[model samples]
Target chain A: MIEIDNLSKKFGDLTAVDSISMNINEGEVFGFLGPNGAGKTTTVRMLCTLISKTSGNARISGYNIGDKDDSLKIRKIIGLVPDNVGLSEHLSAYDNLEFFARVHDLSKTERKERIQYFLEMLGLWDKRNVSVGTFSKGMKQKLAIARALIHDPQVLFLDEPTANLDPEAAKTVRDFILDLKKQKKTIFLNTHNLDEAQRICDRIGILNTKLVSIGTPKDLEDAVRVRKTVIELEQVTDSVLKSVQKLSLPNLDVEGNTITFDTIDSGSKNWPIVEAIVHAGGHVNIVKVVGSTLEDVYLKLVGENQ
Target chain B: MKLSKAWLVAARDFKIFKHQKNMLYGLVIFPVIISIIPSAILNYAVNRDPPLPAAGIPPILDAFSIFLIIGSAFVPLGIAGYTIVGEKVEKSLEPLLAGPLTDGEILLGKTISAVLPALIAMYTGGVIFMVGTDAVSYPSLNYYYFPNWTIAVILFLGMPAATIMSVEFGVIVSSRVNDVRSATNFGALMFFPFLIIYILGQTKLITLDTETMAKISVILLVIDVVLFFISTALFKREEILTKWK
Candidate 1:
């Protein structure tokens, strides 16, 4: 579990992370979401004790990050995967893991077994002997994950784990996260990928200058009250646009050729607008009922904070 | 676990050195080249018309000692320069910092690790030059090439002090500077004092006799102790990593 209270990290006039407070329970996959420079990485850095907080406090696995006595315990309990994959590029995948295994104090047998298992699990067994410099970006990421998990840490702090991965590689990382969840490992994931957050995270926190919102995806959507109704017409004529606009959606915006409207009524659907567009000599090309995505809520919250 | 982890980092650096042996020339070969320069000068002096005063230990040792002093500057610049900056370059520093090791521990590990190989190589070269010079030029080996307490003081006290000072300065430079090369070049400035001392000793302008060497060793050892604590204190995790310049 992780607890942060009014934690603020400032670099001169720039406040990287402002008085942000949140709690992540054990076994929860908490997604820390934000845009670039939105303080997601800074918060994780503070939690991992890589950078000290200018104000307030954070406790990881019941050990206060600011406390010297509990520093080692906190480090032992957390596995961190930074946004950039930093490995001993000259060392083979196996050697890198072996080295970290020793640092983590795993016995020879345990180290070998865990290294083999994680390498095989990450599909890196065959390439174990090759220097990491020879591996692709995805392979390096997988290796980084394996290194992080080598110590069997209680909490995993991942900063943009799959930022630049191909879809397949991203899915592999996702599957690995799910596997960690099965092992009851708590994950503190910092990511800007809203869809990934929605899919993999149990709860999410939107961070701008600070912790702006924290909830499940649905809870965030509800809090922001974003509706998902697809409106399609044969021709997006003036009359059709006027009629669609008159649908009285509270928060509405035009995105390209499509008009997305956020309505207050939970039961109100896009059918009436479709009918109105058709009556106005426009055909509904695409119509589907959807819900507010994590992105919608994230942008809204970030906008409000700004 | 901490000690082992420190060694692990050290070993990893060594392995990486082996892989990219060429890049290590600045550290590994520079010391040898520095030693060889003095050896070459001594070789010429022995063969010259007016022979240099006190050939073997006096002249060659002076050159070798100066080599060490200058080489000490480069060792820290090489090791400490690359320690943090290399991580930043390869983007591995964050994860390393995330480990349980404190800044002092990490620096200690890296400092000892980087210093050992360079120092060992230089010491071997120095000994070989001493023996080689004794064999070729000396009428007898006993008096000219004896292993005196001065030699011990130079190796144990003088060398380590210079090494630590270089590493400390290098770390401070690396923290503030963005580029590793720039940090290293800037850090190399620490060698100027040692170079000046070496030149003065060589020209007989400053007497670097056995007694003077011992005195300098003690003085340098005290300086090293002070600098070590200062470097550790200035290396505040909150200050360098989180704070802005």
Candidate 2:
């Protein structure tokens, strides 16, 4: 449903978003994982037609982002929940949704039904009349989501939807997004919360100015292959340290009497290191090989790119 | 531009304005005070011990009418400030800009939102000021002095042009600043040109006649058109989301 080709955005000498390309299919939850100033928001802005891309091109539902006529058409099919939520403080939650509903030219009856449906679904129906200024951060975030969905757009762009919410609030937003995923919505989610990204996204892309890696969560984890073996010895001697260093494993570290290093294939590679320690007159207290996680892959990719 | 989309934006701002105590008070109080203060002063002057000379009333009345135009110019600054800068501070423009509306449509909507209320309030106060001025000056001058061509030109033409200028000024000022108070303060500078015209009118350097007021109206309209372009440029989503700080 979304096609981007060689997209890059620059502000004078600084490039906010660099050349990157990806396609998001219908009903696919694509998570953009990046740190601060990683151009996640910039990419979303370009796709949502809120900002212009300095170079390259993008299209949503076959409507060009660079074309004025097509930009409006693209906007009609997309709903965005920015990182800030950006809810009107003075307007009531109900009025906020109603105004957006009317902006899309929904009839009065359709407006009423959709507003109530989204509100009830988001668990905000009881507080519809309350001023948004008085709402909690999670409540305001939920209301923003409702406002974006008031017109029932086919594609949704969410930038850091659960950045600052409490655990329960974040879970609520994640659950709501998962429900949308079930409804076959094309969702482009930008987030730094690894767990949230892993839980909600079907496919994930790690970005740092440029698109570093893109794949399923399990696929990304499998690519990193960062099973680490950590051994606690009774005493550390130069011979024992030399014995492990002779292996030249990746990411080697020594903290007090413990030795740690990345194992290529922990099933076959971990035993030699344990035997090496024993031969070097080091008593092994405990030996454990830990599997890699999404964070490991994320940090490895982001750290490598940085 | 889709006017329905514009109206939706305006209606939303208007609904929120209804809930704002400061905006509501500014709407009612400025008009009432502008209408009453001049009428009271004129009445007190006419009832003075010397029974202020009837012959001198014409210039004073002509000059006093400019206050209505000035008052109308000043009124929209607060509303414009709140509507434009309030959104910037709250960061709510992203969602609105993310919709199908164009930049021109959003700017037009905001302009209408600021202009409609100021016109209604100022025009209502204009009527009251006319009636009250007539009540005080009719006996002194031996005739109803209002509803004349000059006052009509000032009210219908000059007032709208000035109000539009104020709103456009608010837009330009809003882009520079992140808060409403700062926007309004900078917007207060917009009235200096109107104040200069009023002072010139009082000094008889420029007559406050129909022809002069009409010319002023056209000049202000030209400025409004120019400022409208600048405001539209500044209000673009890219400039706002990136350049505005």
Candidate 3:
């Protein structure tokens, strides 16, 4: 579990993260969404104790990030895959994992078993001996994830874990993340891939140098939900448009026999509009509510901040 | 500063160095070439008709030993220079820093890795040079001149002090520089002091006796300690992660 309270970071005049606060429960997959320079990486670094936060505080698994005494304890429980994969290219995949394993102070037998398990699970067992430079971008990312998990840390911080990977490779990483979630791993994922976040995150936080919104996907979507109804017709007539207008819909517009309008109450207003259109002798093809998506919510939130 | 973790880092660096041909050349081949060439020249000179005047050993052999010791000190320059900056460029520093190891531990690990091979090569080259000089000067001097107290002092005290100083300097340079080339070029400057010492001893401007050797060793040890503290102070994870370009 992680607790962030008034966490802020400033580099001289520029504020990277501004008093953002949130709590991630145990086993929760929390997705941190942000644009470039939105303090996503900065937040993760502060949490991992890689960099010092300019103000405020954070704690991982009850260990304060600002306390040097708790640094090793915090580090022992967390793993980070930074924006860059950061693998030792000259070393083999196994060697890379071994180095991390040793740094975590895992015993030889434990390190061997964990490395074998993670590598095999990530489908990297066969390429364990090959230098990481020879691996594809996806393979390196997977290896990085494996390295992060080699010690079985309690919380995993991944920054753009799938950024630059092919679709298949990204899917593999996403699947692996899902598997981690199943195992009750607390994952703090910083990603631009909205679909992946929507698919796997138990809760999501949208940030643009500040916490814009944090909730379930549906909750975030509803916060920025646009109440509009779209109606399709087999044929449109002037009478149909006039009849729909008479229903006092907000922002009424007609395009190529399709009518779109905003309504305060889409659930109740849609039926009357459909009946009015039917009364005007227009054949009804479809009537549907336009619900907001995570992308829409993200763009709306980010766009407003800009 | 968990030494086990530090050792892990050192062992990993050593493993990587094993596969690096350029580092191999610097560590093994370079010292051998620099040592053997001078030893061969001395051997050739001593075998001449007149047989260069010898009391115990030729003065040129002592000069060659200093040269070889200094040469061995340079071996770790490239290695230490590449340690921090190279890992930063390769993007490997992040995960390593994110680990439980302290900055001191990581620096210690890298220093040990770079220093060990360099000291080994220096001693190995010293032995080879000694054997070659003794073999060639045998007809004239009739005895082995190496393994003297002065040479022992140079090997055990002076070389380690110099190597540690170079490694500390390299770590400092590597932390500040963005690239290995810049780090290496800057770290190579560490050699100048040792070079000056060698030159002074060779010219007889400074004696190569135990007293002079002790003084130089003490000076180098002090420098190494100061530089080590300076480097450790500068090796902050925040500065490296944020300030480095």
lDDT of each: 0.76, 0.90, 0.86
Q: What is the C-alpha RMSD of each candidate to the true structure, in Å?
A: 3.4, 1.9, 2.6
Ranking by TM-score: 2, 3, 1
Per-candidate interface DockQ score? 0.64, 0.87, 0.78
Residue-by-residue lDDT tens digits, candidate 2, B113-215: 9999999999999999899999999999999999899999988899999899999999999889988999889988877887898889878799887898889
Question: For every model shown, what is its TM-score relative to the native structure?
Answer: 0.88, 0.96, 0.92
- Residues B6-83 of candidate 1 have per-residue lDDT tens digits of 777777777777775544676667766754565576677766777665534465565566566567657657667666
Question: Distance (Å) between predicted and true CA of A297, model 1?
Answer: 1.6
Query: Per lDDT, what order, best first?
Result: 2, 3, 1
- The TM-score of the first chain in every model comes to 0.87, 0.92, 0.95
User: Which residue window of length 10 is worst by lDDT in model 1 chain A?
Assistant: A262-271
Q: For candidate 3, lDDT tens digit of each residue in A1-306?
A: 799999999999999999999999999999999898999999999999999988999999899999999998999999999989999999999999998998887989999999999888877899889899998888888889989999889999999998888999898888889999999999999998899999999999999999999999989988887767888999889889889877778888889978888756556757877988899999999988888789989999999997
Error of 1 at B35 (Å): 5.0
Kindly report the docking quality category of candidate 1: medium
Q: Fnat for model 2?
A: 0.88
Instruction: Write model 1 residue lDDT over A1-306, tens digit each, in one string.
Output: 888999998888999999999889999999988889999888888888777789999998789989877887788778889899889787899998887787777899999999999888888899889999998887788789888889989899999999999998888778888788787789999999999899889999998987889999889988877666666555578887787678776556666556666544653555676678788777676765567677778888898888
Q: Model 1: runs farther than 4 Å from truth?
A: A228-290, B27-31, B34-40, B47-64, B140-142, B243-245
